[model samples]
Structures are given as structure tokens and as C-alpha cells.
Target chain A: MTPVARLSPDEERDLVVAAELGDHEARRRLVEACLPAIVALAGTFRRTSRIERRELVQEGIAGLLLATRRFDPSLGTPFWAYASYWVRKAMQELVADLARPVALSDRAVRVLATVRAARADHLRQHGAEPTTEELSRSTGLPQAQIERLQAAERTPHSLEERVDQDGVAVATVGERIADPQAEWAFDDVLDDIEVGEVRALTDLLDDRERLVIRQHFGLDEPAQTLRGIATGLGVTAERVRQIEAGALAKLRASLARPAVAVPNET
Target chain B: MEPQGTALRHDALVYDSGDEWVELGAAFLRRGLEAGEGGVVAHTRQGLSLMREALGADASEVRFVDVSAAYTRPVRTLASYHAVYAEQLRRTPSLRAVADVQFGPDPGEWDLWTGYEAAFNRSFSHLPAWVLCTYATGSLPEAVREGVWRTHPGVVSGGTWTRSALFEEPERLLRGSSAARRPMQVLRPLPVVDGVEQFRELLARELVAERMPSARVLDMLLATSEVFVNAEQHGGGVVSIRVGRADGRFACEIVDRGAGFDDPLAGYLAPRPGVGAGLWVARQLTWCIDFFTSADGFTARIVM
Candidate 1:
């Protein structure tokens, strides 16, 4: 590892002045000194996309050079703070050029991180997964938004993608054991909860909802199409789809609860 | 191909029963197919199967597209359908379609789908096509049901086709429907600036402070800059700019001194190279760009 050059406040000011005054050696030294910090800054801006760390660092360096020409020490804004703005802007523009299909906003990423933290805390305290409502209340995100965020977090993984456990590769994602009971996995909303808890959640739903949820996900029964479910329930397929959506929402709301108060049967 | 004398007949068929929809849809397509008009059907799997059963021997005449797969993006879908319509019109003077769009589940997605429906009226107006958009009111949300009435100029129901009494003009309906949505929560007023660069910096500070990703912030900045330039060039210059947060989405409202353009479909069509490219870019970058007029002035509110 290369030792990063650290300059004190006055020294940094002198270096900036020297670099700005056509001192090639001083500019080279300044670039070398800021290299480590630039790399670290690039790390935070890293995305899951194909844009590389090296490319981002190059963009940051371009910004640093621009800052060297533009910065006025008399402005009283610290060199690091002023440079950081230019650095971020350059990298941001590069990413935006490549980000035609915009990734989730930083707020969404932070919210998801907060939800994970809250979920961990809930599991630590309660010894079970938290319901969407509990997570929403704890994180201050709306439940609907929480559900949507969770869905968005799922980037489609290749079947060959490795599943890791505590930094160790365990198995491929496709190699995971499937529950024999569910022909069509009830994997969208209530996948995190255990089967027993799922049953408890479903118990809180009315007869129609229970039927819809069961038939839609093929819980213990053969997976039936929405059209088939609609015929069996004596309703339109669209109505069946709506009932299934409502039932899943109900299940998501009631998940991990000790005892859910069932709604009055319609 | 020569331009068809008649405009596209866009109608909504709001039905509760599956069997009835299949019957009406089959009849609509069969008549066209038998008359040597081109036929296309894009619908949910269930709708397709039911329609196929109803059409029986005649089902082979029409092209089938899976609605779930095809209707993923509004802009792309419009482009694809435009191509299909252009190709069909070379051989047949008229085309008929059963377009039972599978609307997305969330509000943002719903906006895209509804916007596509409204934009379709203008995009396909010159094509000799009859599109029947089916809405299963049995399970559809009230907002979507209302969107159906607003977007479609006519309705076909109970074996009768009639002009919808509730049908507002497409541009009016799109603008009104968007304006009718819950007002964004304006947390604070952002400074109105003269040049695009200053406005960009100001908006960037607000969005970055809200922790939006930089790329997204850039897209918003570029888009807002486009609108800012448009304001200067046409809308008598921007008067005020306000930033707001609503349902975890960021909204920037730019109020201008000029009356907003009357064309509702103005930034909607995928712009022809030299045409209104700025607003088109703005519309592409943001979730939506809703234009409104008030006693104060005309406002273009962008949500991302």
C-alpha cells in the first residue's frame, strides 16, 4: 500500500497556490496527495452497474484539476469541501450518461438500508421477522411504499448467482430447496415469514380472502389459474385478482403478529 | 400509404363479465377480419384464451400479443404499436384491435399507463384503426375506472357504441386528471434564478439534500433546465420555482408568466428530430410533467 501524503491547513494552501501558479511538480504532488481521498470518494458513488471504480476515480481527478484552477483560498470554503463538490459533480454526470434507465434514488437506497436495520433489530428483540406495518412504523415509511421498495430491491438474479452465508459461498440461488407444499411459491409478499406464521396471517383473513390467497399461490393445493379461481369463487377473474391482491396485503399487514384481530366476515 | 380520411376510433369497453367481453371483443374483431381489415389482439392470458374460444375458427385471422409482456413501457409500447399499425395499413385500409391493457399495480405505473392511453389518441389519430380498450370494472380501481371514462372519447357497452357524455378532450382530460391528483407537499420555496446554470445548481442542492442519487439528480437537473429554457424562449420567462416532496417523490414546480400551450399532447409524442425536443427530454427523464394554468400564471410541475 502507498503512503498517502497528508498536508496541514497552511501547507495545503501553499500547495494549492503553487499548483495554480503553473508549478507542474507541485500539481503532480497535489494530485498524488489527493489520490487516496479521491478513490475513497469514488467508493461511495459506486453503483451495481458496469461503471468501474477506476473510471469514477478518473472523473474525480478531472474535477480535482478543475477545482485547482477555480478554487480561491480567500473564499474560506475548505479545499476539501470545495473540491468534493466538483469531484461529485463530474462523477455524477458520468453516471447519469450511463444511467439511461435510472436506478432507484439515493433516498430509496437509504430507506431500504434503514428497513434492513429495523428488521434486524426486530428479529433480535422478537425472535421473528417484522410485519410490513411494524417495519413501516419503525422506519417512518408508508407500508405501501415499503412493499414497493422491497419489490424494487429484488434485482433479478441469474440462476447461477452464488448465495452467500456470512462471507462464505454456500450454494447457487437456483439450488435452494423449494417448499414441496407450494407448487407456485407464495414468494412475493410473505416469503420471509415461516409457514406457521403465514398460516396464522391467513387465519386472520375472511373466507373469501383465504380462498383467494390459497388458490392464487397454490398453498397445499394444486396451483390454479386466476380464471379457474374466479370460476370456483363465482366471481370474475379480475375480481379474483383483486381479492388475491387484497388478501396478500392483509397477510403482509398481519405478519409476525402474536394474535391478529380478524376482520368481520363479509 | 395514403392518410386514411377517418381518424382512429378509440373507445373503452368497461365490462364486468368475462364472457360478455369475449363475445363483444370476438364480434368486433370478426367483423373486421371478415371484411378484409387487419386485426390484432393484445390482452391478458385469460382474455386471450377466452377470446380465442369465442372467435373459434376465426381466431386464426388475428395476431395475438401478450399484454403483460408488451405493455411494460409506455413510450416503447407506443412505438411498437405505431410500427405494427403502419405495416398493417400497407395491405389493409383499416385495422381493428382488442387492446385490453393490463394496468400496472402502483400509482406511478398507473400514471404511465394512463398517459399512454391519452397519448394514443394523437399518436394513432391518422392511422385507420379502431382500438377497443377493455377495462374490467369488476376489479379495477375507481381512479382507473374514472381514467377510462376520461381518456376514451366513446364507450361500447351492451351491444351499443355511443359517444361518452363524460369524455373530456384528451389534452384537457390528461392535464385535468394530473392536476386533480393530491397536491405535492411544498416543504419550502426554492429561489427563482435567471439562467439555466444557476437554476440547475439551486435544484441540485435541494435534491441532493433530500439524498436523491446524483445520477437521478442530474437527470432532474437537465430536464428542469430544458423546461427552464423552454420557459425563457416561449412561456414569457419563469416567474417562480418551488420544490416539494410528496409520497416520497420530489416535485419541482416552475411557474411562468405566459399562458400554457393548448396542445395537451405536446411533449408526449416521441419527437421528430428537429421538433419540440426539450420538453420531450424533460418528459422522458421525469415520472411526469403536468402543466397547469392559474390566475397567477401558467405552471409546469415536474415530478421525479
Candidate 2:
């Protein structure tokens, strides 16, 4: 590994001017001085992406060279600052091409935005988030398209942060009460088998998911707010809402139908 | 210091034949059951059947779980296994298990599986459990084969357990495995965001201009905001934020000039009170978040 050569700020600005005036040695020197920083930048990407560190370094150098020719000192930004963008951009372009599948077309992005705007409008009007069916109806998009848009945007949520609806994180009305003693009136005569079935269903969720659900419902402790759940889970209140939504969605889907259904309100 | 208990002893069992797998698995469990420790066997259907046959009446003493069913998602699997380990330990002083990991068919997915294998060491190292992960040597990719050697601390062969020289520390191995190595699309650059409001408005505008769908854009906004704010607070200061279209999805890399870290498990750990969960939130809201460190500083690349 080469010990990266450094230049004083004024000296670096001078080299940029000289290099732009077609000084080959000046340009070469500039690239050398920035090599270590570029390598270090590439190292950040090395652990997480599929692109090789060596290739990234080479790409960074290419960016630095381009910076030398195109940098305009009149803009008054540091040369390395301007050059580092090109370096990072170059590597990112390569990753975009080889690493990921076509993520979304400009058209797809537009369509999704349209659907989301419609959903937001519905939420504002109805004071609740809209379903895909409602969104499709209002947005004039096909249900399949809306569903696909939703599915494609499903991020890999950590157990503590599962976003379901348009980014709202959260729980039921009873769980929303600020006071622990303010118990809402509801039936508590569900059988042991029903309880066991719910347990089994909840078991399918990860630990944090289960924790969020339990905390929200006051299963073992007092019913808590989204903020309380977040603090307990060591996440943001917004993230807690998302996890609660996701968990409830999972539970609802599981409970909707089974050969032996739990008795509901008669 | 190590925890005061039967500390975890994780080993890899690389075998070629079905008979060898059953013989080794039954012997491993028998040795544990004889000492009154609980035994569990998580394997494919065939492996379970063979183990049951080999153990005869002893099979009734062991718990059998279909690996095909249990090993679906890496994080979920870890959580489920954690639950199982906790439950088993409550009934006995120690626990032993045969884990036949099913590394899926797609070669692209091997990294996560290998990561799971390596991560298991940190997640379960304190438990009083002995886990022998079996791998079919014939089917594994060369990279996966190397990963197996690197992730596990011990190797079990010919009914004997020996320390593996190839074993690397989990953090080091995961860092090496997590390095990005593929081609992605180009991202457009965003001007330096001066503050939180500016950052949000600029990033949202960029995504809107790119025609990113609203839900994903919302996610990207929340996720990227967290990364950018983190850079400002902890990363000395923000250098620049680069955003562009990659493979149809939007990508952003927030660069900062700070003394970068090398720990792979940084944000993955459960967050503590008063500690920031920004990285963890960013990780959850994107398709992937890859951390890069170089002499230049650090970059948190978020892809959605």
C-alpha cells in the first residue's frame, strides 16, 4: 500500500490549475495525492456490496482523472471534494449495472408516486390509511399494479422496524391509551386453546415483533404508547408503529381463517 | 470473560454420504442424551428419517424439526432458533443439536446464509449449547465451502471434533463476506444538504424527479435522512451525499471524512436506550445498506 501523498490547500489548488492547463505531471501528482482517500472511500463500499475493492479503487482513480480535467477552480470548492464525487459516482454506476436488477424505471417511479399521493389523500379525507383496493379505485390504476408497487417497495425491515402502511408506525385503540390503568372494556373469556393458537401464531414472528405486539396489547405489562414501545424496543416511535402494523397484519392474516377458527364476537 | 456455563461449541460437519451423516448425527445426540442433556435434530426430511431409524427407540427422546421449514429467512431463523435454544435450556442443564443447514440453490443467496452461520457465533456464544452444522460438501459452491471453513470454530469428522485452523473471527469473516462485488446503476448527485429540512426536501425532490414511487420514496426519505443525520453527528461531518438511479431502484451513498469503523455488527445489534438507532432504521428501510471504510473516511451506501 502506498502512503498517500498530501498537498497543502493552496498547493492543491495550484496543481488543479496547472493540471487543467494540460500539465500532465501536475495531473499525475494530483491523482497520487488523492489515491489513499479514494482507496479509503472504496473500502467503505467493499464490505457491503458485491463489487471487488480492487475494481472500486480503479474506478475511483478514473473519477479523480476526470476531475482533474473538468474541475473549475472558479467554483471555489476544494479539488478533492469535487473529485471524490466523481470517484464515488463512477463506482456506483458500475454497481448499478452489475449488482442489482433493474430496480424501477422512471415510469414506474411516477406510477408509484401517483398511487401514494392518492393513498395520502384518502388518509387525510377518511382519517385512516387506505387499502390497496381503495387506492386502486382512487388512483385509477389496476389493483395488480398497485399491489405490485406495494410488493416491490417492501423493504427488508429489521424485526424492530417493520413498515406496512404508508410509513405510519403503531397499535389498536386500547393500546393507544396513555394511562396503564385505563383498561378498555372487552371480553376476556377466550379459551386456553384459542390463547395457545394465538401464541403459536405469534411465535412465527421474530422476538422483537412478538415484543412489540405484547407490549402494545399489555399482554404481560401495561398497555403502552407507540413512544413507550419504541423506548422499550430501543427504536423510534415511528419504527415501533411500523413494527406494530406489520405484526398486526401478520396476525390478522393468520387469524382470518384456520380449520379451527377462534370464536369471534357473536 | 466467557460466561459461566457450558459455553457454546459450534462445529461444522462436512459429509459426503447419507450413512455418514446419520452415523455422526446419532452418535452426537446419543452422547448428549446419555448424559441427560436434551437433544434436537433439525434436518431435511430424509436426514430426519435416517437419524430416527439409526437411533431406533432413542429417536423418541429427540426433537425433530424440518430444516426446510425452519430455515426460510436468515434473521427469522436466528430468532426462531434463539427461542428454541432458550426453551430447551430451561428443561436441562445443557443442550445439543444437529443443524443440517440448507444453503439454497441460488448462488447469489449464499452470502446471507454464510453470514447467518458466522453471525450465529456472536448471537449464541453465551448459551450452553453445542451445535454441529452439517453441510454436504459435494453440492456447496467453492465460496460457500470456504465460508463453512471460516465461520465455524471447530470441525467434526470421523466421530472426532478438532479445532479448525481456517476459522476466522465472526466479525472479520462477516466483514470480508459483506464487501460489495457487483455492478449497479449510476446515481445522480445531490448538492450538499445544509440541514435536516434541506436534506429532506432535496432528497425527496431527487426521488420525485427520478419518478420513484411514493411509498418507496417515503421509505428512502426516512432511511436516508437517518444516515445523513448520523453522518453529521457522529462522522466528524458530512462530506457529500451522492444519489442516482441504479438498476431501476434509487441509490444513495453518504460520505464522511471521519475515523471509520470496521465492525460489521455495528447496527445489527439490539439498540440500547439513549443510543441512536439511525443506522438500524436505515438498514430496515432499504433493500440493503453497505458500509465502506477507506483512508478517505467512510461511506454508508443505501439502496432502495
The DockQ-based CAPRI class assigned to model 1 is incorrect
Candidate maximizing TM-score: 2
What range of 10 consecutive residues in model 2 chain A has the weakest lDDT sum? Answer: A184-193
lDDT (10s digit) by residue, model 1, range B218-291: 45766787788888888899888888775335788887888777666766664332345466556655656777
Where is model 1 more than 4 Å wrong at Cα? A1-266, B1-6, B14-16, B30-37, B52-63, B69-94, B101-123, B137-153, B163-166, B171-222, B240-246, B261-281, B293-297
Task: List RMSD in Å for every model shown.
Answer: 28.3, 24.2
Model 2, A30-126: lDDT tens per residue? 6656666876787676332244555566666666655554454444566776677677766765554344443666877898899889988997899
CA shift of B290, model 2, Å: 1.2
Kindly list the per-residue Cα lDDT of model 2 for residues B123-220, writing each as its tens digit: 56656788999988887789888888889988876667878888888888787767553333365566886875467656766766655544455557
lDDT of each candidate versus the true structure? 0.65, 0.64
Chain A TM-scores, per candidate, are: 0.36, 0.34
lDDT of 1 by residue, A85-152 (tens): 66676676566544435356776678779989999999999999999999988987666557656755
